[model samples]
Target chain A: MAIKQRKLELGVLVASLALVTSCKREDRPFQTSAPSAEAIQFTRMTDFRAGGPSISGNQPSPAMSADETPEEKEFEENAYMVGEGKRLFSAFNCVGCHAHGGGGMGPALIDDQWIYGHEPAQIFCTIIEGRPNGMPSFGGKIPSFQVWQLASYVRSLGGLVPGDAAPGRDDDMHGGPPENSAPNQKPNDSSLPKSAEMPK
Target chain B: MIAAATARWATLADNDFGVTSGEWVRGTKSVLDPAGPQSGRIHQLFLDYFWLSVVVYVLVVLFVIFAVILRRRRARWTGPILAEPAPSREKLRGWLVGLATLATTIALFFLLAGDHAAGRAIRSLSTDNALKIRVTGHQWWWEFRFEDEAPSKIFTTANEIHIPVGRTIEVELHSPDVIHSFWVPNLHGKRDMIPGHPTRIAFRADKASEYWGQCAEFCGYEHAKMRFRVVAEPEEKFNAWKAAQLQSSVQPATDSQKKGQYVFLHTTCVMCHTIQGTTAGAMMGPDLTHLASRKTIAAGSLPNKRGHLAGWISNPQTIKPGVRMPANSLPPDQLQALLDYLEILK
Candidate 1:
């Protein structure tokens, strides 16, 4: 009886193999468009990381945006959009991973180690499509509008965006300059010793 | 004073630490007393090896006593058989030893055949008439997703799984964080849930009762406390549970409950959990849509009661060490209201 059962299982396994091989390849695109006409939502990505940082600089300046509408063009330098991203940075627990731009479980957002590059669009896509080490994609949980806000804020984290485009402080007690503050200054190279050793 | 202390300890035991002694010795956790066809086959194989070992032990002991120690050491002058110089019987002795060796080989072959039969009985994974469920293991919890051909028909759950009795259920096991094993001793043997690669465990549970399952693999700090329940029921009851799981969470009934709902959504609870129909759609933690219907909370760490729920909400780290959830330091009133809201999730 057991032998017969084993033979049956073997037969079933063979049949499944044939069925799977003959089936068409399923290409499940993870990029979901916005749900409401309010935004271009796709179901695959809408649920990625609702609270995580969004990558597509929600609204880059039309000049920088490949396909920016007038609505999207204003997001580039919009202080309100930048401020909203700052709030999302904390709410989605981005502060938990990339701690105050210094880094903890994730890389330092303020540093030069751009694992995925530093374009506004690149950052936006990086956030949506998470990286290997620790970053989780926040495509769905966070609306696309909020993702744009988050992208603008993340761009300002490394002083990549104009200092005026970043937020300094608020009711939420986030650490940094206001969106209208000074631009990021290059560190002085004069502090380094002329030689690679201490003066004798 | 002593009685009061004893009563306090008893309450502690009930809420934390161990289960009752009766439940341990002859409970659903016992692998010896199986309630499913797969488990029964495994138990039979275990007994087969155990009895075979016993027989081998007895035979070796008898050989040592009668053949080696008690045989003929005192014999040269006392035994006629020893003095006979049995050269003529050498062929006969060699033949006898060869026959005995042949018998042992045949016995071993049958034992191996029995083992193969047991393995096949449990792990066939044939699901033509079977129900399918995906069991994903997280850091210290279990997440269950019922399978359906249609995407909209599928629903996810946490901690508990309800299956129809006397029907094969194919469980696709995977782990997102670390390695873990699923073991419901009363139903089947353990199967490892690896990280990327998924495995299947197919079994037909015959009985209609709650079977306790625990993370048999050491996953992390809370591995020992990571437990779940398999509620095997009649087909109708199982279907009812599934139906309830598919629906969205109910709204709060009273004024305080509504206020509690506001607090829960506003707080950090939404950061890690999903309460369907609300803004709390994060999947970092378990689904809390049908939390109230479950028998226990925190993945079977405590009984689902008002005080335990309140205590757990206040300080999850105290009951189960290294749990991912941090203590929510809400004011007394807000905490009470949140608990009230959570109780109505059914």
Candidate 2:
């Protein structure tokens, strides 16, 4: 009986060892200081048009800032960063080209039919190394963290981000309309684009 | 005369508080209260038209009230008391029509006269041998070039225009992009800077003062912040400033400054900016040859102080949202070096 108990314990150990060895290595953003010079695994622009037209995740590490909270810790899940992105968007005059997501001189961002891929990493690549047709490259100008923040904020605009991370009101401007406001869920997921309703 | 005006305007424009509150300073673009001779005429003509319109409006309202009351009384007694009527009704109708015609003619005369006077005052104020300065409107800034017969005498500057007091400074305005209007309320009324259409605005300031001018038309994102200052100083000071601006890019003396200069030339800055005597001769952005001398950087968005300059270079979009100046992220030490290099530009 004692021998059988020893054999059972040995079997359990071998099974647990196999399970540990087979554990998947997760990709995350690396934690770094502000104005982080670390290279991000940005998606290539050519691949943006291929396949799903969405970005594929590489081996990314979670870049954590010192001054982050549980609620606003992960940049992907942080609502405050989205707010910061909104501010940067206006301040940088992204509205000048993009026209508040409706696209004027630049293409519309708040749509499903993305000319570029529909991934946060892909958008980050697009911003850093701008696409052709007058998309100015912002790689050298913008810091990596802020660029990431802007990318996350942009994703929120398209309703691809988690609803909780998306802000419902602007920091100022008194809780603007739907265009400025992001709802908990996409208001037009199934509906056709409002562009069709507009006079050509 | 220029010296006295310089002191007067300097006293009025030098505000201890800051730029926003500096509007109280007389040289601001206030259309109603003009400080220059040209704007004064425009203001006076505007007031004449304004008062006449007010008087006409009041009289018209009074007459309408009188007619309403008379009509009500006439209608009440329409049965017999008033129906057979006041004899000479035909004559009364003719008299009423004549009076209306006379009132209409008088109103039309004043309207036409005010329009004619305003147009003539602006047009006929041309002076010979005037100081020539060409103001080219960019997407977000004013490029001032002092024009002279000698090609070498032409020097370009941004955001600030220094004119000699008591002299007719004839400014030729043009735009490379969309429409922009140059209006310094204290100096002259708004004039559109349409692309391919050059417009001229000549103004002579009676007193020297720092006057604020802004792009009246909405060009783009940085339109509101596209401001320029007219420094109406003494003739000697104006000439000296203009002369000094002609000097080529002076080399940096300090090691830190030299490094900054090297970094600027080697980086994306040279792609858009031009610094005289340097390889950075691109004209897409402002000329930074005399950048340190300007009162405000980023086209009058912020003071040209060290901290503001460093902050702007670090991330300009943070300060002037939507401004074309890109966010060129640099290491802290390199940024400081660039600031140090720029500070000695004067």
Each model's C-alpha lDDT? 0.72, 0.72
Q: List interface RMSDs for the candidates, in order.
A: 11.4, 8.7
lDDT of 2 by residue, A13-75 (tens): 999998775342111222322332233332452433212322343343454332322222356
TM-score of chain B of each: 0.84, 0.84
TM-score, per-candidate, Cα-based: 0.60, 0.59
**What are the runs in model 1 whose C-alpha is more than 4 Å off?**
A1-200, B1-27, B72-100
Tens digit per residue, CA lDDT, model 2, B1-346: 9999998766554432134433332335566667777788888888887887898799889989999988888778864344455579868988998998998899789878877877788777667889998999987888988999999999998998788988888889998767999988888888999998899988887777777889999997779889888888989998898888999877899999999998787656765788998887867678899987888877777777898788888777777776655677677888889888888887
TM-score computed on alpha carbons, candidate 2:
0.59
**Candidate that scores best on TM-score:** 1
The CAPRI category of model 2 is: incorrect
